[model samples]
Target: MAKNGKKMETQRSVDQEVKAICDIMRRGNCAGAMQYVPELTWILFLRILDEMEEQERQAAEAVGAAFAPSIEAPYRWSDWAAPGSEFRTELFEKGQGNVFAFVNGPAYGEDNKTSLLPYLKNLEKRPNATAKQKVISEVISGVDRVRIDTERNFLDVLDKVDAITSAAIDDTHVFTLSQVYEGLLLKMGEKGNDGGQFFTPREVIRAIVRVIDPSVGETIYDPGCGTGGFLAQAFEYMTGPKNEKIKSADDLSVLKRDTFWGREKDNVVYPIALANLILHGIDKPNLWHGNTLTDQVGYGGLFEGAPPQFDVILSNPPFGGKEGKDAQSKFDYKTGATQVLFLQHVIANLKKKGRCGIVLDEGLLFRTNEDAFVKTKRKLLDDCNVWCIVSLPGGVFTSAGAGVKTNLVFFTKGERTKRIWYYDLTDIKVLKKTPLVSKHFDEFFKLLPKKEESELSWFVDLDERRKKAAAEASPFKKEAERHARAAAQWNEKLKELKKAKPKKAPAIEKAEAKQKAEAKAARLAAGKAKEIEDAVYDLKAVNPNRKPEVDTRTPEDLLDLIEAKGREIAKVLFALRQ
Candidate 1:
């Protein structure tokens, strides 16, 4: 039934239910999306966990195997939160019990048991606790009490959230709880929001996942797993119904328990990531809560037995992040820029013949001025087969509040890059209303099989171009070396003459002149050599097949239009003043 005394459809009612929960949170103390999302995340996580555990318990009982529940009674959703449960019944019937006092206070009832928050927070301290218990403790670590101010508003949110499940959604709609949570994440990442920095557009993640095509038994990782988007999408792609890959029982076990790994540094986003992966049906998401660059460990109980390297890596690390010297000292190609350092880290964390798809800014591709950036790129070219580079539109990240131009880089380890195929989408106009979608890359994947060349796609033979540059730079480099050696000999001779003569003389003056001339010649040769050396390392994608479009507007027409627009603006301003 609808609030307006009419019936609504399945998907529409489900959406309304989720929105109504957010409306209640907005009216409560949890005002902002950043605040309300985290509060909602914990409750949503607990609701789904209880349902999943109940299903597991039934399966265990059918198999005649003993099973220990992750969460016990009175604290579980069925004990206190489910509709018509003991706690809910007592709370509403003659004020026999208080839901708020039961959840967030010292011993309040006749049983005199601990509160829900304190009980969850102390689960990790128990001897021989299950992994699920440890995860619950981490997710509920900072939540000392409920965020909703009033008990009435809190119970309203719980009731609305309880109505949202697979039973409420129609089979024709193909909706899931993960999709509902994805909507909340999208709201967190909209324009003018601070949480936008921790999000990547889902369409972009889908494109990268399809191109990578992760397998069932392979391991996937994300170093900066903001809300675990990449890992969860990979899980979806691997287990999707349309996939033709065969899944054995062993493969299914590995996929459920040991296939995903990630690390997140943020305090709030880390717990949300754990809940997100668990919501996506990943039983053991081996995530470390800390900084990957600095190796600062916050919590590693989940990631305790992780291996050295992974088979496939997909990530969109934080853009425009700047680290300090503490993180810079850990890498050989040291740089304060976050993306460059993460690029190096990715290259090091791959197994032999492993594949990777990463999102990088355009600046890192063309930057030769910084030694760290150039050297890291040079390592990438030497260590991996960088097969394809796609230039995404400048506004692809506009909804996430990032207006920088980005590119998708695909590569495989254990081979050197000889050629690079580039697909250009810069000509396509992207806006906040119209964004870059999965369909935009259909042609890119179509042309990727043969590395075909077209108006929007081209390839560069990296080996041949680099050989030509080296051949051209050889003579100047030799000349520079020869001049440097001569300059050193002349300086030595001048020093000997000064020591022997014990006074200034013509020989000393003559030696000084020869030394100065040799140094000047060396400087000239070195300058020319450096110019060619930098050009060889320049890997910016510039399509040779496409010609620059020329503008036909003459100077007179442009000036006249500018003057007319200025006069119109002045008239509007004059009217406002009058």
Candidate 2:
């Protein structure tokens, strides 16, 4: 009861903070909360960083280890943003009537000289500056967007931001500020900020994470991690109470600093991702602020001196975006399409036996029109075991304003795929209305490890797929050839008949023409009938012992047989497991 009460109180606090910030954001020439949320995020990040650093200092003292503050005294959150603070008073009330100039402008400080932004930037020169301090400096230097009109208004908003934390009040409900921050990020994505490309649905992220099952020490990465959703979800999955995989504080430390990594190219979106990670408790996130498709040698920050290979990858690279010849030159399968290039990159960068769960556009699934597209699919099958594909329902991404059909493709490198299990999720009603939830994937999760087949899920063996493709292609070519040969014979015979026609009766000529036409029609009908007979034989032959009579089945009858076979296989699998 007490815990429930605390949770309810925290819920109230979260709602209050969001409403307050949004209301304050709309007050002046200031735009909507979407533009201003980043500003609030930056401020909240500093405050959280200071508090986290304090906690670390205490922990170090307890263990008798040497520790120091990341951000030095004067520029720290307590010194600058805390109410009744000295720096706050000096900047706002002391000396001149240049409050806005003091912050937004370049002017005087403690000894009557330094500006706020300039002083923050000067922190970089401090010897032995920690990684946390470096991130703080980087964020502050890029904060030219916080355009509050008055000092009072700024202070009021700052106060509201500060109060969002449980530590700011006398409540025992210690809520994580990351939750509220993520909520704001969700809202921003819903508004189609940055074209809604930077956000993946949380349910989709969770479902992918559950299947991937990232471990504690595994180096998990997202090549195009938008808002760091996959990495964040992976962290939570590994650290959950049921997951005792993380055995030590050292493991926890590694998970915090090194495990989760990503790259974001958009300038507007990079800061949100960075701030998002910081708010999620990563002091030093290994996120590169550049395109993931950039050449590994040219971009050394994330890749280091050599190519980067990871144990697991979760990504939803941008679809329909073009990378021209220059970008295509870096990849083996050169295509202007962004998703195709990302697919090649993911395949190349994954370590042998590394697993990947990627969301790709529908075009990548069946597009064999281009050499690059065919080669990409061929390479995927040749080098990876594409075990499952979950076809996501349309409008799953509509909240983000994307209407393209998407699929979650799961595969592992260094193995040839003999068969691919496909799960058709397009028919689920909840996905169209209530949207996807983890429960929607409950049955999929159960059947996935077993490769169990259901009404919505079926297997397509590579050998069978290849055979089907060849058969489909051969019939068209062969039929066209047969028609051409028959026409040639008819024309040759007609010339001979024309020469002899003067001597023969017109009635006899007409009867011969009718007979020839009927014969040609009969040949075409027989050819089609033979094709249907062959398909039936193949279907029945799947069960080798059953030599059923030659009975031609309709399309519906064929579908029923396939479903029955799937169920029988599923039962056998379950029985064997038992």
Best by TM-score: 1
Question: Of the candidates shown, which would achieve the greatest lDDT relative to the real structure?
Answer: 1
Candidate 2, clashing residue pairs?
Answer: 109-113, 109-114
- Per-model TM values vs. the true structure: 0.91, 0.76
Whole-model alpha-carbon lDDT for candidate 1: 0.85
Model 1 alpha-carbon drift over 4 Å, by segment: 1-12, 91-97, 106-112, 241-246, 505-517, 520-524, 550-578
lDDT (10s digit) by residue, model 1, range 426-516? 8878888897787888888899889799999998888987888788888888898898899999999988888894676988999889888
| Model 2 clashes, total count | 2
Taking all chains together, the TM-score of candidate 1 against the true structure is 0.91
The all-Cα superposition gives candidate 2 an RMSD in Å to the true structure of 12.8
TM-score of 2: 0.76
